[model samples]
Target: MLKNSLDCIEETGKGDISIWLTRGNEEDNFNYLNIMDTAKGIYPKQAEKIFESFYSDRKGGTGVGLAYCKMLMKTAGGDIYCKGKFNQFAHFILKFPKID
Candidate 1:
């Protein structure tokens, strides 16, 4: 994820990747991390598509990064999703299920 954000900065001359982590709430299903980047953000329509394997716009980009991340999170009983605005920023939130 950092690489993706860094690449965006490298390509666009905009550099801002904010990573925030939080503890899961015992009484509620919670998100533990947020990765927001000021890179060339995704359009609302592309948000879902970004998680698809082999989907990429950049040259030589295999497009497996986010897809892999989604799979990994699911396997660990968590969920991953992206929220972003076109030409603005992309925010990735990772939610982990509550544990006893």
Candidate 2:
């Protein structure tokens, strides 16, 4: 996903790019997540709506991936979140409580 986002950024030449990877918590054992891009302007707002079913800027997506991810995580006791700018970039966080 990081690679794809970077590729997308490079292709569009729209924003500054960077990636951060953090280890999962010992207590929750959440899946490790990678956050990429320097989301600044519209991306944050865009992200919120992106999770909605049947939503997509591109014609190809049924706009269900993120929404599905959210549902799957909830079923497993986790949550996903995103924040960023419209013109800048965005950050996404997926957290799962440490499972024993």
Candidate 3:
């Protein structure tokens, strides 16, 4: 997650990143760690495609980072996703089930 955030920071070089913990919807039954970058964001189309293997736009990028993250999150019974607008911000949310 930090790697992905740092990549966004370096890619845009415009604004800083913030990370915090938050609870999900009651029905959702999970907690979340949100990492948001104020730098320029990707298009919605690109965002949808980012988790696919070898789907990077960065030069020399292997495009394995996000794909791996998604896999790992699923393995742990959690999930990761992104939200943002082009040239505005990038928000990455990692969600985990609540433990009693």
Q: Among these predicted structures, which one has the highest TM-score?
A: 3
Q: TM per model?
A: 0.87, 0.67, 0.88
Per-model root-mean-square deviation over C-alphas: 1.8, 3.5, 1.5
Model 1: ten consecutive residues of lowest lDDT: 23-32
lDDT of 1: 0.87
Expressed as tens digits, the lDDT of each residue in 33-80 for candidate 3 is 998887777687888888999898877888899999999999989999
Arranged by TM-score with the best first, the candidates are 3, 1, 2
- Candidate 3 at 76: error in angstroms? 1.0
The predicted structure with the larger lDDT, 2 or 3, is 3
**Whole-model Cα lDDT of every candidate shown, in order:** 0.87, 0.66, 0.84
The C-alpha stretches of model 1 lying farther than 4 A from their native spots are: 23-27, 98-100
Return the lDDT, model 1, position 65: 90
Error of 1 at 30 (Å): 2.6
As for lDDT, the candidate ahead, 1 or 2, is: 1
* Candidate 3 global lDDT: 0.84
Please report the TM-score between candidate 1 and the true structure. 0.87
